[model samples]
Target chain A: MRIGELSRRTGVPVPTIKYYLREGLVPHGERTSPNQARYDEAHVHRVRLVRALTEVGGLSIAAARDVLALMHEPGRGRLGSIGKVHFAVQAARQPHTDEPSESSVARTNDLIEQRGWHVRPTNPARAALAGVLDYFTRLGQPDVLGLLDDYADAAEKLAVAEIDTLGGRDVDHMAEHVVMMTVLGGALLNALRGLAQESAASAKMT
Target chain B: MRIGELSRRTGVPVPTIKYYLREGLVPHGERTSPNQARYDEAHVHRVRLVRALTEVGGLSIAAARDVLALMHEPGRGRLGSIGKVHFAVQAARQPHTDEPSESSVARTNDLIEQRGWHVRPTNPARAALAGVLDYFTRLGQPDVLGLLDDYADAAEKLAVAEIDTLGGRDVDHMAEHVVMMTVLGGALLNALRGLAQESAASAKMT
Candidate 1:
């Protein structure tokens, strides 16, 4: 595929694709000639992933670049698998299924504890959500860190919900059923609470 | 109190306070002399409110100015109450005790019906969280539009577990708990879901 074909498939403009290429965010295409470059499926997928990360996941270009780098890391060993999970879940959502067996949970638990610790806290949001790691330890499940890493990637450091309680950490996937309910739920709760406060303030004034 | 005192109490920077005053985001302090002005507790509170609405609520200065204008609008009756709810909920949050009575619920229902419309879909976020809303509606009661306008808040929107979904509009204070739970719960669920997804995806690829 050429640049136009790639553009047609991904809905990203040719200029924007050039921009991503220039930024080194997108991989270089095969050279067809001195002036032309040949693109492929990898280019298509890469653009889609980039678009989702920046637009849907609401990550900055720099953040999206870092996340892509993390995803592209070697996946041969346990570390690779862990890295893949970190990359995918941070951007794409996993739909729910039935409950897992004790053994599956155990493997997930172990994988989370072992390789997950490699993800250092990049921001206070992840740092705050790191609090949940202790809770997971108590529950005999250490995978919360991996989940938190994934979350930190997707949610962009909503850790201030733990601190000042005024920061915006709205979930990225309002498309997912679980996420939407939570957003609406927050909205409704926030509304009634305000109504109640207003009533109280007026009562006092009266 | 001088602007410095207001700054000390509200923790807003002196420069920002001067900006707010000059921008008319805050009323000009009473001039004590050619260069001196005095503010009061009311000024301090208003500044804090303005900051909360602008910073946390993510409203532009012009937008915040417009919202504050509605807040100061006297004798708008129920519209006045709606503005109060709008501002209060947007400023992070606060807890409340006085639940709406059956009468209040009925009043809201009548007002919503009379408006010949549902909730004005206040936030642009609705398009994102539609999936969660579908999930919630499928489980039981499906009156989100009715309740959304009745609440007209971001934080008040929420998700209840299948077992705990609020059944009726008339339940006093029920909306607050449900909505708060929804936002916080959604955040938690998204975090967990992100984990589940990462775990599942890693297992397959690695």
Candidate 2:
């Protein structure tokens, strides 16, 4: 199929599809001629995944590229399926920390594990920002690092509640919103937490 | 109070407080002498808000600046208190869309009224992301917008369930986690939705 058919089938525009191709998100289609390229079912699958990440997951192209990289790894399983979300959330958690090292992420993970917490390795969110933990740690702010486990523990319940929340919607709408909320809602959670901290200070007076 | 006393109270370092002042996040303290700056309760409040926005909200300085602009307004009781959250959530719906015009947002409210979809503005997340509707309309995409609302409705139910799931931790931790989940959980929600989409597709094939 040409790009138009792929766009019609995927609900993405031809120009945007071309952009994704240029970005190397979707794999190169087999060229039937010097000017024509042919797409297949794999292209269709990749396009849907791309939509899920960009439109629904709210990832930037670069971030989406990282996610696709991990997804392309052999035998990633359900672990790979959920990895990008994890890396995204981790990036959201410590955005200013900048590029962290593998050891720093490992250190934070170790700290969280020491506190008896559970976080999925395959989560793409952690993978994407895998660098920030080290950078932030180098800043010598242990307070944020200390909160990692508690953050994860809090996150685990929210994830379950979020899934449970999906139960009542029409299946089609439910699926898309679930993905959107997962990304957008995660940001809201952080805002709510900040306000709660302020409220706590005010509440102390009472 | 002296800077030392303020530091003792807030557990924030003197240098960090000075940085906050330089950044214009906190108002300057009264200068007692050539070298002395005397702070007060107002400084304390402002500093706390700044720290909360940085650490907990994970907002970039510019993003935090935009949010604080709405917050420091005297009329925050109405606009600042909750409406800001609503607006922020809406503004935040799409990662890459530019800051929208007031008229564009108004146009969205008109669409919601036209659709006659049952929703509430009681809370921002509850009624937030009407900006998403406009984006969808402009893009000629309803399936995605419809899914966003559906996700919100589901999340409302899950919020209640999550509260129940919090089987009596300290109030601060509970509140913190609630906030954390609000943001992080949304990302997880997206992953779930995508997985569901994949499942649905696979089922059709099978």
Candidate 3:
């Protein structure tokens, strides 16, 4: 298929496809002639993945590129690759200057210890969780902090279920699955939470 | 305090504060003279809320303004106000031209019915969940659909806890709390899930 067909199939514009190609988001198509190139099923799949990452997952182009590169890198353990992809997705959003507060960090560490979660000390999510805890305190809604354990409990269960689904998958499949589930799965859970909140509020508030 | 002091107190720059004022994301200060306006503690709080909504929640300026306006609207029941805020935030991100597929909508309805939820049919989250269901199918990951119930289960428990915390709060406080929790709480949960996934993957992957 030509670039035009790739654009049509993926619903992405030709110029955007060219831009993605140039940015190394999608690999170059085979040069069929001086002015023509041919894409394949892999290109179509890659384009769709890129769109999902950038459009639905809200990852920046650079972050998406890094994720793709990590997916293709050889010799890293599956856990290491998953960790790197998760860190890459999050690191793009955090500014280096905005450090988490000490109290928030202590609170996050307390939650981790209480849960007995085996997360690395340097997991970006440790800082991300602390940042949110700081925001809750700054917003004067420390009462909400009481529910942190509940959230963590649910997160543990969900994560267990998520990993169980990855059983027996190869490294490449596992990496892609983790990235999609980490990003798109977040969106799915968020949307489900919104619906559940509506139902709960209606039943309780009225 | 003037706009400069408001900026200093919130750590938002003067020009960005001015822009928020112009965008109606923050209430205007009282004009003390032709060229001078005085802000107050409320202004500081509003600026911080605005920054949190846009910066942390990833809401657009217009969406943030709509959320703030809804917070101030009179006579809306607490549940109604929360529903409106959630709808406004999600609606801002969804383009009107895109509609969820019928199968996805049916799946969402099935999940709600199975959960015995009392959500209104018009809840934006209904469509949002359907859209994500569509994405999972489109991505050729229908196996993930098996986890929908687990996600919904967690969402339900979290929502119950969230609404329980709102007990006895007045409508105004409830509205703000719902908005913050809906947005920032989602972030918190996402971060926690990331951490949990890291631990789970480590234990199960190797």
Candidate 4:
């Protein structure tokens, strides 16, 4: 297969494919001649993953490269790759606020202790949660704090399901699955929340 | 009661406050002189809301302006403001993928019907869900679809809580609450999910 066929198959344009090649997002095809290159099944798979990351996952080229590097690393297990991918994904979501408050940190720590969650305070996700709480505190919306337990319950259930699914997959397969779920899972959850809000509001009306 | 005081109180920079004022994200203060403007407590509140929308929500200036417009409109209730703010916020989250597959659309419609959700098929959130599912199908990861019911369950619970809280607030307060929850809620949920994942993984080790 050639670049043209790859483009047609993946729905990614030829120039975008070239751009990914230049950015090292996709591996270069074999140079068959001065003007021709040949791709293989592996290239097809790689290109598709690239599209998923960039287009669906909304990851930048740099982040996508980091994720792909982790995925392609030889002998990397599912857990290791998931941790790395999780870190990379967090680093990629640009943070807009400055330092969080001490109260926010205390609240997050308390939540973790109460729930017995295994994540360390140093985890970026913990900081992310603290930031939201801090902003709420600043804005005087303490009522929003009441929803934490419910959110945690839902989140815990989701994590168990995700981890169980990860247990059955091979390392190679696990890499893509981890990235896709971690990246797009937020969007899916959010969209469903929006739909659910409508339903809730409708129920109230009746 | 000056711009400097508003900045000092909100932790937003003086230049950023001016920028927001110039961009119409925050309402202009009363002109006291050719170069001096006197702000009030309301100014402080508006500036904080603007910061939340732009910084935490990652909404563009234009979208923030639109959201603020809806918020400031006279006699607009919480329900009306939520619909408008939801529209503005959705417009701000730039979609990376193109049109979704027919199957994706059909599947989303089926989910809404099966769940008896009150949302219409044309809701942007439904399209967003279909787009995620379509990406999953394209990536040959139909297994991700299996988590839809669980995700919906979580989403519905959160929505019920959110709407319940909204019922107790006045229109003025509801405007800010709706935006904050809708924007920062995703971050909070994602962070909790990350913590829960770590907990699940740790349990496996033990």
Which of 3 and 4 is ahead in lDDT? 3
DockQ of 4: 0.67
The residue-by-residue lDDT of candidate 1 on A1-206, one tens digit each, is 99999999777789999999998889999998998999998888678656645544435687667656655555423343433435343433221211334554554455346545223222121321232332233223232233333333322222112111111222221122222222333334334333333333333333
The list of candidate 3 runs beyond 4 A from truth reads A76-79, A93-97, B77-79, B93-98
lDDT of each: 0.45, 0.49, 0.81, 0.78
lDDT of 1 by residue, B84-115 (tens): 43443344232211222454345544543553
Residue A119 error, candidate 3, Å: 1.9
Instruction: List model 4 lDDT by residue over A5-56, tens digit each.
Output: 9988878899999999999998888999998899988887788788777765
Which has the higher TM-score value, candidate number 1 or candidate number 4?
Answer: 4
Task: Rank by lDDT, highest first.
Answer: 3, 4, 2, 1
iRMSD computed for candidate 3 = 2.2
| Candidate 4 Cα misplacement greater than 4 A, ranges | none
Instruction: Superpose all Cα atoms of candidate 1 onto the true structure and report the RMSD in Å to 1 decimal.
Output: 15.1
**Location of the lowest summed lDDT over 10 successive residues in candidate 3 chain B:** B90-99
Off by more than 4 A, model 1: A75-206, B50-126, B129-206
List the candidates' TM-scores in order: 0.46, 0.47, 0.93, 0.92
Docking class for model 2 is incorrect
Q: In order of the candidates, what TM-score does chain B achieve?
A: 0.47, 0.48, 0.92, 0.90
Give the per-residue lDDT digits (tens) of candidate 4, residues B63-136.
Answer: 88887887678776646556766655664653466677898889988988898889955467877888888777
Clash counts for the predictions, in order: 24, 23, 0, 0
**Candidate 3 lDDT tens digits, B134-191:** 7787777766788988999999999999889888677668778887788778878888
Model 1 earns a TM-score of: 0.46
